[model samples]
Target: MTIAVVWLEDDGLWCVSDTRISRRGQGGGVQIVTDAGAKIYPLNVECRLLTVERELYYGRRYGMVFAGMTAVATQTFATLSGMCQALQGASRQDIPSLRDVATLLSKLVELYVRDFRASTTLADPGVIEILLFGMCPVSRSYEIWRVSDQIVEGSLHVAIDQQPARTGDVVAIGSQVSRFQEILAELKQKTENTFRLPKIAVGQMADASRGDVGGAVSIGICNQFGFQTYWSLGLTPHGQGARLMFGVDLDDIGWVGPVVISGGGMA
Candidate 1:
């Protein structure tokens, strides 16, 4: 299991995820592994193969953070990659809209479920949830769409729900979502919260049972400028030190500053 958190602030969209994977052992106990898993995948990128850390925030204006079964997540990434390749081959004017992308993702999950049911007798493929966040070129606003799939009557059911985030909206998914919500609420009640929001979210997940959700936390931001990594475990020690000391590298990642959403092209 994994924990992923996404929040919309005045600046842009912030996403965070923990890196831990678990499986059932021969004794029927769960075995937890860490430091070699990632749950965030940036969409709309130009790359032949997607590398979880390096390519996730590369040349992306949109991205998706996922939690749940790793097999389902891998299939979802493949579907998105294929869609992106198809879009790249089309005319600039033929690029799919954010809404269209969300629709396509839902359909892809539906198909995956169908195939899973055909090949296996498992009633469910495991819980799968995806949060799609990005800037809408047409509306000039940041939007978050929740895409989820569940097993219902031995078949997979998919749902797509979307909402335009106002400032201070927060969303989280995975096995530790309830804990995250509790932390957020407690922080809100405190007049002087010392912890960074993402850190707090990740910390709680890391403290869960047998540390099923423990590991380094990765973060990415998306806005009018584009998508870029705010923090990643894959970064070199030097890169991590630089960011901790001097915030984000605006020169390299492009700064959004305080953007006003107007119906226009990317800044």
Candidate 2:
């Protein structure tokens, strides 16, 4: 089971992980270390892909990411690449908001699920969920939307924190949503006396987990009510294994700072 989390903040955004992934039917000690040696699927468009078959593309005014079980990673990536190609040449300033991105991903997942269900050998394809965070310049507001997954003949579940959503915020997407929330709750409940996970550290820890294919998480933190800092974590499964990729998108006035973090696991 792969798990990921992102955090958006005021000063800057950060992403991290534990670098552990487990193979199917593998027992104890048969673990895959993402840090040791693994192949990573990098986005030529400055985006991140997840093991669960979702994609996150970052733009100047818009940031978008999604997660959930679909077909194999290669097929999902091909579909996403097609979507990106369809999006190319459009003005960055006129990019879709996070909500719009999430909606599109949800729709795409539905289409894929339908196609898979029509196949004879595929059996059951898993579910897909998308969490979108958007910022509107004209309204000076942020919006977060959680799009539930609808697999043709399968089930996919998603859960989030109880707190009200915010624009330029983070989300956890996977079968292990409960675990993600537990981590978030533990972090929030910590007192000032104990060791506190910095926003970046928390973001990273959230990003690192097991079975995270096509999975992703994000965080958004504000700086004294100014611009926002965003961190996003993604998983991409490859032949016999998977890798975790991360990135940060900063919403500063003058300069735009973005970074990509990559690591993989063995078969």
Candidate 3:
């Protein structure tokens, strides 16, 4: 089984999940979605989960932190701790060094894969893939983390080269990425005014092969005053969901005060 989650906080965004990939009855966990439909019903996968109920830690932007655990507990904690350190050390800006964050995440994934191989776990386990997104200093970018369980074998995980377009980003996971994109495109084109994102949009982003759990996506605009008009799109094993929110960084708007936009357009 696998689990994933994305959270939006005042400071930034958070994404979390587990590495285990299991099928029905494999873990004795109930499927979150209904199985009624003439269309194909996506297979429900398992994941370690953390959310409002299983709170772990908290931050400024993110008031509550949750996750679903797997066998890779040590690896998960280490990776998260390392990410926090990197973020703390990173220079504060519009997009907080996304490449740097992605680099750190990749390193932690590799480290965990190596540790698992060295350990006497399940001999040879399959690899795991996770999709992560969060608010950065500039714009948001997605990171793909793949971990191979096969000992001394080829990579079980691979990062996608191109980032998906973020016209109206949503927080979601599942087998509905393509379908979700189609919906977003249609929404934007159909709107009479500028394609401004609603506060948040959530739904399932699935594909033909595998479904993602605890996945989330978000997008919108940040005006010159540092006010964020944002939306999130999320999808879990159960179904599609969305949330809308607006925020201003206390440090930017309160402490530093608003800045003037050079161009006439909103920042």
Best by TM-score: 1
- Off by more than 4 A, model 3: 1-23, 27-78, 86-96, 114-153, 156-174, 185-267
Candidate 2 TM-score, true structure as reference: 0.48
lDDT of 2: 0.39
Every candidate's lDDT: 0.65, 0.39, 0.33
TM-score-wise, the better of 2 and 3 is 2
Write down the TM-score of every candidate: 0.73, 0.48, 0.37
The candidate, 1 or 3, that scores higher on TM-score is: 1
Off by over 4 Å in 2: 11-23, 26-66, 70-78, 81-95, 120-126, 137-140, 151-164, 167-170, 193-267
Show the lowest summed lDDT stretch of 10 residues, model 1: 241-250
Model 2 agreement with the true structure over 102-127: per-residue lDDT tens digits: 45555665566556556644443444
Number of the candidate with higher lDDT, 2 or 3: 2
* For every candidate, C-alpha RMSD to the true structure in Å: 9.4, 11.3, 14.1
* Top lDDT hit: 1
Collision pairs in model 1: none
Off by over 4 Å in 1: 45-60, 88-92, 192-198, 207-211, 232-267
Error of 2 at 12 (Å): 6.8
